[model samples]
Target: MDFSFGPEDERFRAQARAWLAAHLVGPYAGLKGRGGPGSEHEGAEDRRGWERELGADGWIGLGWDRAHGGYGNRGATLTQQVVWAEEYARAQAPGRVGHIGENLLAPTLLAYGSPAQRDRFLPPIARGEELWCQGYSEPEAGSDLAGIRTAATLDAGDSGYRITGQKIWTSLAHEADWCFVLARTEAGSRRHHGLSFLLVPMDQPGRIEVRPIRQLSGTSEFNEVFFDGAAARAEHVVGGAGGGWQVAMGLLALERGVSTLVQQIGFASELGEVVRVALRTGAADEPTVRDRLVRQWAELQSMRWNALRTLGAQSGTGGQGRPGGADPGAASVAKLLWGGWHQRLGELAMQVRGAPAAVGPYDWSADRPYELDALQRLFLFTRADTIYGGSDEIQRTIIAERVLGLPKGARPST
Candidate 1:
């Protein structure tokens, strides 16, 4: 594939850069590079306003069809999307607060939702008026999604369902207005069967609870959400009841969409910061540290190219329109590549920081006992990169079975 950007793409990039510069001012000026992976607790309300700012300017939902409140059909080409992502990261804009709604939920609704459902959900998301969270992983499930025990029973007197279970590691659940849940609808059903994709509101008292999970990085962006008979309308079910496995899998595919490019851009920024610190601290003068930095730069370039190739493959196969049709193994491969790369980057970050990496703000009288610097936080957070989304073992198994046509691994007896 030709990697050169044409005049149109360059123009788009300039426009994106200019918009970010102009809008990232006033109250938002201080937020530049403030809210990211381990620092999600910073400037959250302001970040939500920034999300609306993007929506008002038609920057959100660039990949969805115009009919669905997006820019246009095949909304923005792969190149244009990449340009925006790169520019956004370069501008050091605040991390998006509505990413779950914009990237994951909106696309899933476009793919598998009814017209009414689309009309209801897409507009709020497009306007950045609401936020969403994933309800896939449970305390007992995590990466083993097939083991999710969150169940929803049909209400006898109403056209809704009552959800009752616990969801752990629910990122931004406290801020989300809704949750797209994968819950068992059919009784006595096991594994992937009998599951339904239900859209549940989070505001109902006596039904839903969101208890923030404080992390080692001193953030509560992740939460433990409890549903004690939380309710969702029947029409809110995407891809029909008992069809959640397919819908959930489709959403997971969307998780590896153009957003992966955006993520890499952020990764590049973090890597750049590490290099700058190393140079200032004389860590770069050391042969080993310098060698690692060079390798990281090279690996980042390779990751960008791989992302472009994956995007091209999706566009060629009409996977842009049918998100569920994208290559499954490609998603696993991307996950494995970036997950390991990020974890290593974290290690390198600490090495560059040297002895100071061990020190953090420690005050017994303060509300928080400790405060970590950016590098220390990065180290602690990325430790879970390979574990949270999908473990290295799971990704390897996926590539082995799905991509290589290898024999399936033996399942443990329940």
Candidate 2:
């Protein structure tokens, strides 16, 4: 359990910091601290450009190995990857539009995808030429993901699959170049069985439609994507055709990798802001506010250590399966820890402002709609923290059955 970073890691950190300082300038200079969590709608075009800047500098896939028919990723160690995440967060770099590809999709491909799939997809993601979105959650399947009803039929004519289904709460689907979708490929198959993970192109004019879902936060980062006979090349299938359940599960585990560390760092920044606000507004004089702030800081520190302890274990296997950590349920544990912690921080952000928190700074121009301030948006968005990303209930069930060896919960008839 060594938590310390050596001089080499520090050198990598310095390199990352210097690169960010050099590039986050002029047009991009105003983008610092703009896009994150609830604020994904802000500076999106600028952030996409920033993604290209990151890719050009070899910062996109630090952990991807060039040895496995991969492209020129930095091949950096897990510690160095964490160093990069930390530096990126501390610099308040734009919330990465490419994170789904660079962190989740890339790793999943290395572990399960064919070499051809890797060659086709990895390079664009590394170059930031393409962006991706996950098509896992459907209207009926969200937390009970095995219940997905989306179906993909193989088309013998064009030698591809014709997929027809709807995906809801799809983050950034409106702007994505492609979508990795989980759909039923076997007619009689039920639940997680007979499912295929299909790579769907988003540009099909008549077949695919992206409708933005407005949130209480007044942002439409989430979307509902309809695939009415959307086309997917048969070659684009990863982990082969009936193997999507495994691939999708593995990607879920990877969701808790270095990005968790990055997210925790962002949580720290949010907490700091709340503390400063409390002090400025004299809310710190209240014993309850002071206690809550101190507790949040302590919990955040604990989360950092847990993430570091699990980083090596997860990295060994590309964060797939029950990644080898002190606790086999570390991924679930991490999700539970942060999801609730972040939601609380958002509540605190609003609480510190008292009456002013209810109101917000808005641009009520004749052309644009009203907007919520950062803290107001934070409160609104975190309301869904426990519900999205597999949900708190789902995380707990994973721990109960997988980690604690409890009897499986009942499932409705498929």
Whole-model lDDT values for every prediction: 0.87, 0.88
**Residues 1-414, candidate 1, lDDT per residue (tens digit)?**
875888989989998899999999999999999889999889989988988898888888877767554433236767888888889988999999899998898878877888889889887887788999999899888887888899999998758999999999999898889999999999988888899999999999889999999887778879999999999999999999999999998888878888899899999989989999999999999999999999988988888888888778777644436664656698888898899899999999999888888887788676666778888889999989999987888889988998899999876432
Top lDDT prediction, candidate number = 2
RMSD of 1: 2.0
TM-scores across all candidates? 0.95, 0.96
Candidate 2 structure quality by residue, lDDT tens digits, 178-200: 99999999998999899989898
Candidate 1 has a TM-score of 0.95
lDDT score, residue 213, model 1?
A: 94
